[model samples]
Target: MADTILVLAWLVLAHLAADFILQSASIAAAKSGHGSRALAGLFAHGWIVAAVVVPVGFAFGERGWWFVLLTGLSHIAIDRAKVVLTRRAAAAALREAHDRHEAPRPPEHLGRAWTPQPAALFLADQGAHLAAASGGWAVLLAGVPLDPGWTAAIDGWLGSWDRVAVHGVASAAVVLIGLAIVNIRAASLFVGILVRPVEVTAGGEHRWGGRVAPAPDPDIRSSTSAAQAPVGRRWSIRLGPLDARVIAEPEPAIASPASPSTPPLGGSARVGSTIGVLERILIVVFVLTGTDVAIGFVVAAKTLARFRLLDDRDFAEYYLLGTLASVAIAIVSALIGRAALGALLA
Candidate 1:
């Protein structure tokens, strides 16, 4: 039983190492949908998972082969299914958006509005992977045989069970740290790209980018591009001549709240990205302490805090979905942590 748990735990660690640590941004983005690019990403990821399994499995003898094949093939199958499904869903969404308006253009000009739910799909993909790992563990427990003398070797190799655990814990901690540092940043960027608002031209071509944010360089009037900017607002560059004076918005008699139609409330994506980092950290805390239910409170608080936007069904769904995505990512990360911890203590 201990060997079963040990092998399974290490497999989870390997999965995280491969999926989150080794996979690159280009692969992640390309693999979100079914295409040649997506196939390439899936194959590359499957191979990486198998490669990680090869060295780790050496500790398990013949059973290692069964574990490797099961987990690696399952990884490929899950990812391939996800790519096909996600791409289909995204295309359907784009089609629905197109159908809404006879002529598609900017969201401001066209009556149609549609954006891919990359955030949700990405979260679902991760949750599926974790679930698959769990399934593989169950398979090992039910069928695969552990080496009868493995415990003797483990004890002899490490000097004692306590020492074995200590070494395991240290190794696991290194992997977990790599997970936290690499996965969070990479996941954030991947989801950011996936969910970025895309504009589809009437000609059936998809285009990236949206309202460009105010550049950090304050000297906006210096560039040839500054001619298109307006004078007063933060988003506006100094468009006037060299001697022209600048004026700010006059203080109103009564301060009004920012409207839904107004520009993004925060100045830049920095605030949103920071919030994501914090969300994942809290999730790690909750998972490690076995306080998963508190995650519900986090979600509830966000929903209530944005109660004003509840009337806008579209906006509400977007906010709720994004929150759920964050929760899902955290849950996966926490599960990986638990697996690593188990390897250490088992």
Candidate 2:
């Protein structure tokens, strides 16, 4: 049973390591295009799964390469599905937007900005990978083949409880720590990029979150110029769901020469990053200590902090999504760590 649990952990660890840590920006960009590069990245993920499962199979006493084969094949299928579905959805959105481009629509449609595609696709991709992993776990639990020799290696990796006290370290302990760090560091980047609004700039090109893109040729008229009627000439584009028109809103005019004006972008990057790390830490600590109710206090505190700003539905949704994502990541890490620690202690 302990071995079974370990196998499950290994699958999850491998999934995280491969999907987030190992995947490069170039690969992710390529995967978005649904081209040969997408296939290549998908294949790369399969190899990663195979490498992890093979050695674990040896230790977990699984005979032959059935585990590897089963896991790798399933992982490939899931990844391919993720790639295809995301691409298709995006393409369909483009087509729809083209049809609606000429239609009269209001500027700054608050409700449209909150449509969750990029975020949803991301979550769905991860969920499918996890489900595939569960299938592999089920197979292992059924008792395929085991090499008892693998126990020594497994034991070494987990480390003994007393030895950990003296040495101030344990393999499983370190793995958990790394997992928490990676979740905050890398996963945040993914979420940030996904949720970040793509603003249609003056040149009709998209920029992330603001009107900071290089000014297009001042003499050249963009097709979007006509669409700027609602928000004056100075405005920013906030993109909506797949194929949805960009929402333009007027940038606030400066009140006075002496008064500092707020940039439409809003929020301090450094401060937000700091808050994210702190929240993840708080969630993990609260979960492991068995004071889960404290998690609610944390949530309430965050809500109260932002309650004054809820009038802006777009910003509110962004805050809400980010908060939920942070809490979810912490909860998952804490639960996995707790389980692994228990088995190691037992």
Candidate topping lDDT: 2
lDDT for model 2:
0.57
Candidate 1 whole-model C-alpha lDDT, 0 to 1:
0.56
**Among these predicted structures, which one has the highest TM-score?**
2
Q: List the residue pairs that clash in candidate 2.
A: 61-145, 61-146, 61-147, 62-145
Each model's lDDT: 0.56, 0.57
Q: What is the TM-score of each candidate against the true structure?
A: 0.57, 0.64
Model 1, 276-336: lDDT tens digits are 6777777778888899988777667656766886787655555555566667777886887
lDDT of 2 by residue, 17-50 (tens): 7766666655655544445766786677778777
Q: After superposition, how far is residue 289 of candidate 1 from its true place, in Å?
A: 5.2
